[model samples]
Target: MASRRRSLATYAVATLVLPLALAACGQGGDEVDVDVTGTAPATPAGSSPASPSAGGSSGPGAPPSGRTELPTSKRPTVVGTVVTGLEAPWGLDFLPDGDAIVTERDTTRVLRVTADGEVTELGTIDAAAPEGEAGLLGVAVSPGFADDGLVYLYVSTAEDNRVVRAELRGDRLGATEDVLTGIPNGFIHDGGRMVFGPDGHLYVSTGETGEPERAQDREDLGGKILRITTDGDPAPGNPFDSPVWSWGHRNVQGLAFDGEGRLWASEFGDSTWDELNLIEAGANYGWPEVEGRDEGTIEGGPSGDYVDPQAQWRTDEASPSGLAYADGHLYLAALRGERLWRVPVGPDGAGEPEEFLVGDHGRMRTVAFAPDGRLWLTTSNRDGRGTPAEGDDRILVLKP
Candidate 1:
């Protein structure tokens, strides 16, 4: 457990135990003040992106309900280019044979890319409604992919954000079926990221759809980390008896399990700070009520129990999106920061975070560990927020 330095002491448990009074609220206006530890490494000359003005949410989050001993780790470096010429590529996963299944956000196109750099269009999800930041987002290959041939997706529709699954046939996807539905939706803050945990349950991340109040509403699906079975039922032992595994998240976009099966998420913070949290079952991550660290600051003051992030950064330094754990470190892909952040994790919790590939790859969106132990990193230069370089959207393979 890394030390948490806050301006205020921890709140009493009695106040936090009361039923939350849900009310629509605007974004917090107070300046966020929290003790920031460690320093970001400098980027290469002439490679840095313009410093971003504040306004975003979440970077990464914590692990699931489980814990285990840490394993040996390794550092990763770019090894090769897997493919290029993509359009706002977001979700990425690999097939049993090592073929990559990718999703393009705006195009709603699902693609299969071979290791040799051969790209093939698998199909498109017509139901996906691509807007400011929502569309066909995260993709997860079934844990039983070799046998079930199923792939799951988190998609934004005109009505709501939902999870759907389809069979992966040769070179194409079969008819899609609803796995879960009725999540809130918005033009921005549509948290969409999915990964299967070692417990064989599906973990889904959702945003508050810009409704700060919704994040605190236990009945709402938005702004929550959900644990469900492949069929979308609430996973056994869930604290809320619903899909929610954790709550009060602004917008969680990245999730990865470490060697110990503990889950970590990268989140986007609003204006003040971006966060990397170790998720735990039923934990509450303060949203409108608090931003980065709950210094007992904020206008109304911190009234509820909220989990402090294991690590945090300025929004300009880490509007982090994708996250992956490899070689005993958590790799975070920063969008506004234009860098990859490596945070060392050990028995005492997260260590000092270091920056890498700063501005080297403009606006990284996703980073995932491959079957062969290499990492697949995707650039989000074409995501409408970033200035695209030549090959705007592409994938880079890295060795750890």
Candidate 2:
């Protein structure tokens, strides 16, 4: 735990020098064409590697591919210029005007980045406590932002991990109000990812706070995906009649819904596996009791009682964080694997994942789609585990 703690702390402090390093590389915008070849280090045993598959097929129960059109058999290329000088940038959400709001995990600083690469400090979360992975993590622009101008954040406070909503008053965030509270918080496992589902409800992912038991405890708020309204009340028709939607997760930082409205989450594993699970309502994902797809371990929930991950990787290959669904694929940003993974999805299931930008940009954290049909990826090189480049912690724009 101490080593892990140090890693997280180092990542935070390393960002302090990011501005200086980025300035030497030409400050704001620098163009570099990235090779999107699906080649990285060989997949370690027990994890699936990326594969090419038919692109337009629909997954089971998936709706017709209307606006979710995917690129067919084409490799993505870097858009040449990157948005630089971010400090441990964690979450990204685009505004109606094509501007983006980015969160700095350690500093609790929220920045407004224009489509043209202009950066401005929007505001900071005063109560955010940065320890290990606990800090201001995720940000989401209100679905109704055109009218209400509200922004939501998932932050780690001194007392607990919570979600708060604020208004964008001019250039800074206005007074904040808590939307959800009482989620368990610790130095290491404060799961922090928030997104408004297509169903018009807010879905929050939480970690087990380094306490494995909480993952299985249906009564606990940690280690589960919670669904609620904008005002923090449980969403109507929740499976448990509480905020808890699904249970038995260790640390889930990535959440995305496909064209089919199926929820997929990325989970961090103990030492063996990292999982990309197809989440179902009220289903239990074996966490303390199971690691990956049942390696015959007795520690998981009883057989036939828990759900298995649709895809898994050795922890070394994928400690996935933020997730985005675009063009019929799920893009996962790997922290330890230091690459962008693209998994093709259809109504059947997930195809083999392909790795991109491997070792080109160190420790990718978040993958989000822009309004212009491009993929915006953030690096975590300044986040302790990676060797910082000239413009460390940059946002790379990729064209699919």
Candidate 3:
């Protein structure tokens, strides 16, 4: 597929720059809010606009009220590479001191990379059974890492998909403890992205493991966004009285929190549309019932039975995976589309989305904003999906 880059528009520093920080929710108390001063691009011509009712509440699952516009910034540029020669790098989160903890999906290797691009293998997660899309996927440092020294991991085992944590004792990991368990696992669709919300609760995304019916089953752990404490207990105000915060999703891989702390997710569609959804508490996404908009297409939108996606794209254009919110925009890493999408958002709604770094890196996977005000992106060519470049898989740094 041919890639396209949108033309950017310059905005004044005083108006465009706002207090935004890195994308990680696991920064603990060291979360630094910085202004990424620059210009933002206009949506390229011929691009589709976002849903008209993006900020308005349609019903149960609509975006909540009291939303506001975020500070906009300039387009991101690649400054340097943090590391290279990585095999399917997946989860990425930074420690308080700015070093990153990275996870490898198939190799089950956990690594700590310094800010200057020095890579060190911390340990291997022996419990993960790597097959297909399942393995050691998401890694997060504890919100209280300075005091607790704990780091959490989301791994796929033979029995089930689970989250485990261990102490980061310098160069090695201590014994692991199960934080949460019993999520449905499969050769495909084992959703394994995790992030800590500003509320200090862990938010986990789970796929239905290719079973469409499992998405609607409340008792089933699959196809849901779960909120839990660090100890694995359900958070206090969960709508289902269980760990489930939202349900009825078809393979959600990307999760990020906007400046207003609203949760947003990127979902893979079934041969139709890929979605960028504004998630709400207890809302149903109409996985098997709906794919994108309520345009009455075949297997398209439901009749007010499910929430609509904020924006959508053709499947070939955007098999979106990792998502990050930085500088008042949502950055989506696309696999099949092979581009980074920058969608401008506000309390009113989403604007036209522009394409960035298109086809320059193959099969973008994880896109995280580092504490030092740059973007960290990983490639997934070695995951048996895309054509591998010389590096096959690498971690590149971008300035946004």
Candidate 4:
């Protein structure tokens, strides 16, 4: 595994220059070459469009959410173009047949975009409470999907944030089953990203819900990395004998495992710093007490008790969301930074992170590895915090 990771790193470095060349040639105006130093337009407040819900009403007895419409923009130049016309698309997972499933944050819609760019609405999540940063967030296909046809979703409901399982009945979604519940929910900081780990257990990242104290509370589910079985029970061999795998996280949105089965996570910091951590069992990451590193000890904790972050960036430069590990590198999607970052990994640890596509795509979000070895990235410009260009929110396929 170590040798393979090193080889993949070589391939990634050798082909890294292709994107610059493609940007210069301007392939049919599909890609843009923008000045990284230029100022971006002021972002409009609440710019995401309210997609029509499938269950007649948008939420439980609530009125249809207001939609914010913007003019479409030209698609950016990338190695591959799979599909277009995704509204606030967040999570992405590909099926065995090469078709991909995507989740729209505000719309609560789960769409299946085929390999040929044909999009079919699989279903809409009726329980999704679309507000601020909470809604239908992450989607993952079950490893047994070929037989059980179950797809998992992480969403925020009116009362709290939870995880549910929905069966795929033909083209539409079947009945829903609640797997986990009682995660703290708020207008902001509802950490909602889940992935099945290499161990076949579901790993969930939750936020402190604007309450920094919850990060240190081991009993609370908020602001921690949770490890559970598919049945939502705490997985065996857990450090705390509970779902809490690690505590003291602010808002973790990105989770990925390296080739060696080591877990890496991306977290959004308060105002000073954003962090990338190597998650471990029963570990405490200083949150309210420490932001990036422990400059000094604080009350209720000692500095040596907490583990420092593996990598950190200023909050203005990196509000990282989704993370993907491929070609011996971890690709982190930065929201406020408006760029994609590549961090090379080896047996020693992660090296310095390098920026890519700086200011080219607005508010990049999720990064996922497709089955065909291409890296799929989503734009979050239409999420109310970014200046949306034409075709503002799009999925760009890159060869990395």
lDDT tens digits by residue: candidate 4, 1-400 = 0000111122211111000000000001122322111111122232222221111111112332343332322111255445555567788888877778899888788988765566788999999988878888888888888998999999889999998999987789987899999989887777777777877888888888889899988999998888889999999888788999888888887888888777788888777667777776777777777776554445557323666666666665568888889768888887887677677777655666656666777787788888877678888776767666765567777655
lDDT for 48 (candidate 2): 18
| Candidates ranked, most accurate by lDDT first | 1, 3, 2, 4
Model 3 Cα lDDT, one tens digit per residue, 225-307: 88899999999888779998878787788888878677788888777667777776777777777666653333333323566
- List the candidate 4 regions with Cα displacement exceeding 4 Å: 1-77, 295-299, 302-304
Q: Please give, for residues 231-341, the per-residue lDDT of candidate 1 as tens digits.
A: 999998888899988887888888888766667787888876677777767767777676666544334423346777767777776788888887788888888877777
Clashes of each: 27, 15, 2, 8
Which candidate, 3 or 4, has the higher lDDT? 3
lDDT, candidate 1, at 270: 85
Residue lDDT tens for model 2, 160-207:
999999999879899889999999998777788888887788888888
The count of backbone overlaps in candidate 1 is: 27
Model 3 error, position 354 (Å): 0.7
TM-score: model 4 vs. ground truth: 0.80
Candidate 3 segments whose C-alpha is farther than 4 A from its true place: 1-73, 296-304
State TM-scores per candidate: 0.81, 0.81, 0.81, 0.80
